[model samples]
Target chain A: NAGVTQTPKFRILKIGQSMTLQCAQDMNHNYMYWYRQDPGMGLKLIYYSVGAGITDKGEVPNGYNVSRSTTEDFPLRLELAAPSQTSVYFCASSYLATFTDTQYFGPGTRLTVL
Target chain B: GQQVMQIPQYQHVQEGEDFTTYCNSSTTLSNIQWYKQRPGGHPVFLIQLVKSGEVKKQKRLTFQFGEAKKNSSLHITATQTTDVGTYFCAGPIKGSGNTGKLIFGQGTTLQVKP
Candidate 1:
């Protein structure tokens, strides 16, 4: 199982540019999430999906969007990249919402917006 | 939004020394999980604590959940160079409109000098 995979391990974008960060999991998880980690900061959730066709905003949803059309994929969209959007982004997925539910993360994509 | 904080932003210890990090939340949590991220890597699940005052051990690492479920701790015994990384504590925030999203702490970075 490839676990979770993310594309574009590294990316550099100019202000106002747009891009889609792709995430996919072979574990067939029911939940998926997108989080950004700034240097020395915690993982700030940008968006998440409970299941196919169900998406919601998280703690830090501004400047980002997400879609969950299948059980194996959850992609994050950066509408207009800004300097503040520069950070390492991670994608994670879990089997279910149980007490023992543990999320599996991807290698993460490093983005730098100038 | 629920917030989690981890102390000792950074900790440096010589090989074979002990190290510990604490995570505190502003509100009660249903469950807490610990993850480790190696330098330039993504977060990986270590363990999850559900019961209050629960403690679990994994080889050289010990994880504990507070009696109130609002805090957690990770202690490493005789740290090694391979233990050098950032440790994070996360939980499914409980409050108005829960999204089953995990709120992560501002991880504690550990530097083990061999």
Candidate 2:
């Protein structure tokens, strides 16, 4: 399996601009998540999905939106970019929600909002 | 709300020296998991601790889950250059139930000088 994959390894956006971060998993995981990590800071969940067509807000979902159109894809959207939104974003997936389940993360996308 | 906090945001060790990082959660966890992220890379699953006061080891690394199920620790017996990366601890959000959303610690960045 290719595990989880995220598009655009790095990007720079101007204030007020918008873009979508794409993510996909070949592992057929029912659980997918989006997280952001600031420099030297721990990650904060932005949004997540339990399965195809199901999504939920997370700890830091104000500036972001997400859609799980299929079991393999969970994309994040930024409506109006802000400098505070600049950070490394990660996509992850898990086969299940059991206590023993482990998350597999994709190489993060680094965003710079100017 | 749940929060996971990690101590010693950054640690630098000489080759062959030992290093450790600690993680604490504000709420009780059914389980805790550890992940390692290399510089410019995505996070990779390390291990999961489900039982209270659990201790697991992998090669030169040791992981422990607190008896209260709200704390954990990762220790490296002999630091190696390959160990240079950030370590993170994560747990499922209480009451979320089978959704697989997690709260992650800020993370501890280990720097080993060879």
Question: TM-score: which candidate is best?
Answer: 2
Q: Could you give candidate 1's per-residue lDDT for residues B1-114 as a string of tens digits?
A: 567999999999999999999999999988999999999999999999999999999999999999999999999999999999999999886752435578899999999889
The per-prediction i-RMS, to one decimal, reads 1.6, 0.8
- Across residues A12-113, which tens digit of lDDT does each residue of candidate 2 receive? 999999999999999989999999999988788899999999999998999899998899999999999999999999999999988878888899999999
lDDT per residue (tens digit) for residues B1-114 in model 2: 578999989999999999999999999999999999999888898999999999999999999999999999999998999999999999988898888878889899999998
Chain B of candidate 1 achieves a TM-score of 0.94
DockQ of candidate 1 (2 decimals): 0.72
Task: Kindly report the TM-score of the first chain in candidate 2.
Answer: 0.99
TM-score of each predicted structure versus truth: 0.96, 0.97
- Model 2 pairs whose backbones collide: A42-B106
Best by DockQ: 2
lDDT of 1 by residue, A2-107 (tens): 9999999999999999999999999989989899999999898888898999998888899999999999999999998999999999999989866678888999
By summed lDDT, the worst window of 10 consecutive residues in model 2 chain A runs over A97-106
